[model samples]
Target chain A: MNKKINWQYAMMASAFLILALVPLFMSNNYYITILNQMVINMIVVFGLNFITGLAGQMNLGTAGIYALGAYTSALLSRNFGLSPWLTMVAALVVGFLIGRGLGYPSLKMKGVYLSLTTLAFSEIIRILATNLMDITGGTQGIKNIPRFRVLFWNLDTNVKYFYFVWTVAVLLCLLSMRIAHSKWGREFKAVKDNVEAIESLGLDIKKIKIRAFTLAAVYGALGGALYAHFNQFVTSLSFTTDLSISYVIMLMIGGIGNILGNIIGAIVITILPEMLRFLGDYYQITFCTMVLLCAVFLPNGLVSLPGRFRHLVKKKGKGGERFGQ
Target chain B: MEKKRYLSITLAMCLALSALAGCGGGQTPQPSQTQAAGNTKEESQQAGTAGESSNDTAEGASGETILIGVSGSITGAAPINGLRTKQGAQMAADEINEAGGVLGRQIELFVADDGGAQDTAINAANLIISQDVVAQVGPNLSGMALAVEGLLSQAKVPMLTGATSPKLVTTIDNPYLFRIRAADTVQAKLAATYATQNLGCRKLGLFTNSNDYGSGALNVIQEYLDGIGTAYVAEAHNTGDTDMTSQILKLKDAGVDGVIIWTDDAETALAARQFHDLGLDVPIIGSPSISTPQVSGLCQPQWLDNWYCVTDFTASNTSDHVTKFVKDFEAKYNETPELYAATYYGSIYILKDAIERAGTTESDALLKALNETDNLQGVVGKYKPNTMREMVHEGIICKLEDGTAVYLDSITVED
Candidate 1:
């Protein structure tokens, strides 16, 4: 999976270049905040791609996984006065536990049943977050969580935070790509495409499924930790079933199992709503309409638009039936 | 196939790149969106006053008018709260502008809708902060207020909101916020004192929806009841709980003489109906939520026979200014204005008073003027900042006669 001077690598290079140069031209921190949020979403989507995108498991408990990470990081750092970096490790461990916890249900159930199990798990977390007033501060949420600080460096400003999150996101993305392209990646896809074939070949389907779930949860928890520190606040209400579904939407609206598509999906979905803010009360409705259009037209997401056009053009040249595969 | 991959990858990122382009160009006002910005409220949507566009952070740079940003949950779970804030603030701005604008400039109210979401609320706050508003008001709920208070303090823009939770002042020690509504500590005491002194009840049963808002009030009421050496029982239910009868029945089994209910509008109405149906006939005192049109539209008239609520503003008040407000608000919005409307409406005038007194729209000067606010009359109550910068300390306790809140007594918490 080593990269040459290829177009895909070129695209990644230019995208990062554009991001690095964005704040130079734009002085406003609001846009920088949105960029930072996109980076966080990207990391979560990277995690989500493992189970829901690559492995063909529909996991909908992202908010619960995320909240656990955020709360773990926020509470540990703020309450115990631990370094944020140390608490982030704690968040990952919490994520691993949650992944293992929910991984059990994925094995016991499949499809809609598995979805419901994860949804219930997420809701249980939210309810606990809301009710455990002493711990999570109930619905009022924990605010004033301090920003990241090293020996002398403090990522306090929006621009500084964006770069830190972006660096982490890029490093995490490369790691996820490595895993997704590894031998294990093929087995995960094999488990999705034909579990019977993999099982007959003596490959442990249980390990594959659990590993996918764990990877997804781990990514989600890290995203949550980044979010908690970025906003310097954590509210239970912020993480809802809607949030879980949005990540799934990011997966579908990007090409499923496509790494590059996931980033595109997260960026488009997250910032699209903000762009539609000009519509006032109707902005959400308009955004839903746009997403529906994308879903209906590009079933494989925006990543397939070029191939779709090429396919359509070749059919026309052959005087073939329109939309003929 | 490789060429196709290259083309597709470039095309794909171009999509995201254009989105980034959209962000860079976001400050420019889109003419197509301008018409959509005007809502279908009333002829009240007249003149230059729809300056309240939630996304108009870009336009206020002209500085012709004194731009004041407002943040509210206009599109999310509790949209009514945000709408009421918008309507109330709009009316105040219109009145101020009509009476020859503040500081020789019209007060342009720019509203940023948070949709009851903390992240969106933060975005709204940042947009407001970037808009260079002299001062800001309202992201009405306590959670939204606390989330944005630090930003307001950091930006040095004073904010006034109708948040009732005492935690807004107590939890975060931010000096930028001034709570426009009576804190729950004052309101809870009023409900308890009104029950014990006015209704002449001995034992109090605490029935509450066990959410953040409900439990916060529950703790305060429990502390007050405990201080008074009153025997009490407690029962709780979820926010959207269907059958609250078990909780009510538990209170009844305790043989409590009076019940203090802390919950939101819909559930409070449900509880009141259940209390009536279950024959728990002692005085039923409720939090401020029950005094609004939300509860009135839900419960039947007779169900409120023995019901009382501690509130900051009631429509039935016969005070000269309040009636005038009630009449004007009803005429303009074609509905009874809730406490949110009243507080935000008064908030605009309060800012006007501050600007006029301070003689400058600068942040520090206006903040100083707001901090020095004395018995300044507001539609809800008098405007006077306590030590915590909470504006209103007194709350009106009202009993429902026939679906109308009949004001009984005004309880003031001594600082």
Candidate 2:
């Protein structure tokens, strides 16, 4: 078991090392920018994984939380000239409060009702962002958002932003991983599988559910803050219902109850559309087809591919020997 | 068993890495592939000669090709606008290339779809900039233009778009950005002026949608009406709103002599139909949307009678330039050129003129040439950039007569 854990750590380290060296070989700002975006998506998905994956709560309000974080940080930074770091803290606090406020009220409603509430929350945020012209700049959106700066190093370029975003993403991943492995993580999962069982265990399922939501909101806001600083712009159009759905799709495709699955899913889903861009009008159709295929064939998600592949390989090996003899 | 699991995982990682590497490799071959497939023999020979002369004259100006990036919504909501813009820009590029190209070099256009979203627009802008294009043509929506203005300014690439927001050029103060369409404020003012001065409207009823585009137009029209001292009653509706019965009743109860509608095509049609159903015979003035084929087609022919719209382009106008543009656009795309198509088509020509006058694709030179633009004729109108980088200031008010939008009067605002 210890050896297996060591192997997993080694794999993770190598994977990260490769990512770190990518900018050295790939110098195109376009690809690097896409990478930065992918990392931001991963960070958001990691937070979302806690609620939808571990705690078994569907969060369709991610885009709303994301917009709140972005608008809060952008308004603060643009209006008061606050540091990016300071705005990020403010965003996290706002996200936590909103998530708690939302989670507490909706906890009694399960499944589709909760989903509808979250969806309504997202639409409400978008409408506010659209109508609040004085503060949110209406649909024209807020521009010239200050980039992330650290001492003398300004993260103005994509390469610099790549490091900044990935650094945040890695830290968030570590934090999420820690939570996933803790006693609280087990309780969250217990609530997911059977709320009655968790209640019988004397755990306050409501508190655990709200806590999951709060943690997810923190990650979502952190991702949003990083995104606003990196893109250096924020618009209500950036936080549509489509984005919320895509985040849910990424979490599902990456696999529920798996940390690495979130990262892999985010990367694939983000990069796939870009890769298929050359297909012109057919790209969206092809992308949806591929996603549908993945969902149908890989029921456990892409994270289970390795285990499935190994099982198939062993079966094939036995069949080959039988046929040869 | 553990070993097999480890091997499979390692293999999966390798496959993923290779897939990423494949994407990188895929991009490098595109330019060469297009060069091989898209260039004519004569053009290739000219490019070779131009390449040598360019290298001798300047370090970076000798390339045989100049790429202008075009970004807009080729898919998702409002794709019709994007499609028209793209077709118009492509038509311009093709025409230029046919006419010996610009400055002895072929024009290459890299078009990306923004999906009409802010984040996608940013990505498209970054992608286009990475190609080292001299300028960009779109991200056609106002919201999209605002989102990408920062990135384009950072790259020092000039962008000419049809987004009607005045802030695209004014509030942002990004010199690299220019607009080919008249701003919404200008359109609103024209509507207001025509409603009062030409139609003899004293008490006006203003009906507008609630979105940024609609509300922005509403505010400008309100300010203009106030300036003219015309008493007005105003009502707002949401974008997807189908019922305007209550609002229409209010306007009729107020006994307004004229009505100005600022909304999208579908909503405009709905309101017009509702007004006719209610037997309100007041002269109605609408923003550009009511003049669109989609909206005009939806209403009864007589329902649209005496209705006027302040539009950027009226294809039925008798100008020789517009006639030719309409003819050529139909010949090429088999569709009538709308305001979006006309404006984007004019933007490419305007950019081409700038590039030719500057004799180089350098950002500063192109900007200077653009700023000095004077009365260049195109499909939209005579192009002349004001101090605020607004290229087109003229709008035509077309009235619906006998089921067609006929040219009524031309209004040009002086800043």
Candidate 3:
């Protein structure tokens, strides 16, 4: 319950710096570009960690929200007269409103019910993106998305895109950390742990849930905006049910309830395919096998690995209380 | 357990990274380079007329690296055609490179899989763009190409794709977007002209799948018919739709003289089967999508009777490039390359010629060079740009008979 500059943050910063230097070491520009994409996914995953990890509210509509953000920025900058900067702001605002609307329904739903509602909400958004040819450009998609540039850094180069995505990611990481340590963060945890008990405290559980949803949407939208500029195009296919499921699984694999875990999960999943390229068609099978193994055996995910290692080291003296402690 | 897991994870990571590192740099030379090196080298050498023609390419930038990007559905349902295009492009690049690299620079190709989606096509385009390709060969499908058109057009990167729609070529006036294949209107006009003028068929019944490709071709066909004041019967079906009994029944009731099939895959063949089951003796006229072997494989062999198809790529072409490309492609991929692959392959070669002629990767130079290309003896067919804003030229037409698409005739826009 204390705000501390912990070992976890140190590990995350180290990982961030190492990932930032990946493009430099790799001979293949293709992988370097793929790594740049992984960082973008990390941005979205970190946001997912906010609602799913800290708040314990399961929203599987990250892809929809991500698409909303991307399309919003794309439409505004390309169709309207607004610059990409203002378009991003519009994306966040719209994303927050949509998230809140979807979240408000969750007040009546609980657990899997809420998850289903979010899933349905994502599907509905996807259908609209596909069917509405006049507005969203239908399945043909909105094209000519502007390249991203922030603080005078043009994201045209692989290294530059990497820097920009990571800069935003790190900033989002710090912000989420700060918020997770705040009082509102504790209320979110309280609502997650026991809604009835939190209701008895009269702390307004519904309000906290909505806030968490809005926060998650804001993160998703920001990531989507980054994706739009990075890819320079927005279409319905980019945000599918698979992408939505991947976000949740990414959260789980990285370690639920751990900030660093989200980053690790994002990197692992994102980099896994690229790493498996040597196996060719067999690589996907191996990758799936590894993920399944982790899910079944290491259900606590990669985040708990370090703690488990520490526990084993100390368990030499005392063995019984290992899991409980 | 934790230490073992840690060590295992570390070992796993190292093994995976090393595996990836090993696979990193070994990709086949892309379409542009293969065409430039392989085809040109053979033609440009040997103190003869071919050598003199090769000298034209040799005089320019001859060893400079020109990277061209091609994005298509390489691993998805459309992989059959996508792989062929990739091969064709690569072969063209190899030939061009061997002939003495374009502008003294060897052409390199960077291809990405679109997975048959507009977003993926756009992603593939961006991936290629980040790697700094001079031109792009495809984002194969009309919808996918439309999605990425803005980026390529804005970047002023010329995209020479065998896209089938007039919409793709109309999106910009930037001269960067050029179609190697004929637009929909060209195919429609050819079909209409042939159906009415040559075949002496009248009172036609049309069965078309419900997609942009089908609808666009149908519209053009109908427009051509209307210009001739011909009243025709029509019906519509959807993609992936196997049952065409309802549409066929309606068309049969219309007392049609002949039937025209406008569809892309299984659905086209399904319509043919439905027509036959009903014992309808309607002479079948199919759109270009009906020319692929998959369509014939889907329908009964008897369906070939009175069944005619119009397409830009002739499976029966005896042209040197066409013959060699088809031979090489079949030898390598172990399958008869379809029109999609032929057009795509031709697009890659067309791009190589443009880039080489332009002598630089500058968008304007490439656009001008592409626009100036006249009577280019391409593998798909001869190409001559309209020099207009659209850059859409008339496409040649071929008719299918006995499983082979024989070159029936050609059409050019009248001055």
Question: Number of the top candidate by lDDT?
Answer: 1
Best by TM-score: 1
The TM-score ranking, best first, is 1, 2, 3
lDDT of 1 by residue, A1-325 (tens): 3342254456555566677778887767677877888889989999999998888999999999999999999999999999899999999999998898888888878899999999999999988898888899877889878889756889999899898988998898789778988987898899789989998999888889999999999999999999999999888888889999999998888778877778778878877777777666787788888889999999999767766998989878787654464
RMSD per candidate (Å) reads 3.3, 3.9, 7.7
lDDT of 3 by residue, A155-207 (tens): 67657777878888889888888888798778878777888888787788778
Q: Which candidate leads in DockQ?
A: 1
Ranking by DockQ: 1, 2, 3
| Residue B385 error, candidate 1, Å | 0.8
**Candidate 2 ranges with C-alpha deviation above 4 Å:** A1-14, A321-325, B1-15, B27-63, B276-280, B294-303
TM-score of chain B of each: 0.91, 0.89, 0.81
The lDDT per prediction is 0.82, 0.81, 0.70
